[model samples]
Target: MTTRVRDDTWVWALAGLALGLFGLGFVVRWQCTRGACALGRHEWLFDLDAVGSLPRLFTTSLFLAATVVAVRVAARSAGRRRLWWAAIAVVGVGLVFAKLVSAHSVVEGLDGRGLTLLVGTVATVVGLPVLARLGRAWGVPGARAVVLSLAVYAVAALGLDQVTGLAAGLDPSPLPDAAATFVEELGEALAALGVLAVVVRRLPHPAER
Candidate 1:
């Protein structure tokens, strides 16, 4: 009972820390945008849209941590289960790189809309069944939460971003551009943290198999 309580506490604490960092990043962004600081001097650090910004670094850290945990989980498993964990680790590494490099902007420059559609279709057609199998094989604490967080991350990083771009191109968007960026970035960090929290919770002790 005590162990379970401690595990829950750790998850909540990590979640809170992730939210706190996100809020601080947003505040800095808001201040910089409103002329409180020299925009050119601080934009690289505070701008949510900037590559390698604080928020970007934070998101990357979360993904990297999740990837490490996935690798650890893979090391302890075998057969199809090991393959699933290995795939997740690979995706997590890709996410870390994407966050650091602002890969989405590069994609947008090269027929991003069509590419996103193609990728989304393939993911849905292939990913769902694989996920179903993984869920059965995963059998770890917080597996559902990890899966759900990944879904949320995909929606925010992909779907919401495309909508934001489309709205900006077509008309006045209901969401301010900065606000949309904030939500998207925050959602991504939160989702990554969510996955990390679950994996950390489920990670076996060093003494365990």
Candidate 2:
């Protein structure tokens, strides 16, 4: 008999992680300003200031979550084993505690074109092998879509702000700080959800337990 786990296990796990992280960011923002949250002044306290780096935090966490998911799904489909997930559990638990401390850390956005290029290029190179392995099994069913979605996500989540900054720096058409934050955070959330969707789609499903 093939060992099987419910698809809902990972589905719920990833969903919860994303929502919980997003909420934690909000809580930190709220507490930082004691809930003042005025339009002009509160923006910095939220995520634009040097009070914690949501972009780095979420992007790293979510990317790690994806790695966990991919490794888990691959293991499940390839073998009847589940022990590999324990590694992810360790990091996830540690991160839960780290969030509180991160509240006081400097706010860092996905700035720096050089950093962006390096991260994107490295992720693509590392991911190519994994995707190829999946292709051998899933046979391009949804792999291409996942790649496209994640590419769009990376650009939207990590690159938009840099572009806005460059434009503003060059021509002095600066966007309101609040508006910029909103756009950046929105991109982060959307990209996160998109990646989760792709991961969920790739997980192997059994018709019945």
The candidate that wins on lDDT is 1
lDDT of 2 by residue, 30-136 (tens): 44445454545545433632334554455546656666676656465533223323332343344334343432121233444556556555765576446545554
Worst 10 residues of 1 by lDDT: 1-10
Candidate 1 overall Cα lDDT vs. reference? 0.70
Model 1, 1-209: lDDT tens digits are 22533346755676677667666666666666666755567667766667877777878888998899999987886677677777778878888887888777776678866686567547645874567567676664445666666776776667667766765676544335556667777777777777787677657655555
Give candidate 2's whole-model lDDT: 0.51
Off by over 4 Å in 1: 1-5, 9-14, 17-20, 27-36, 112-114, 134-145, 170-175, 206-208
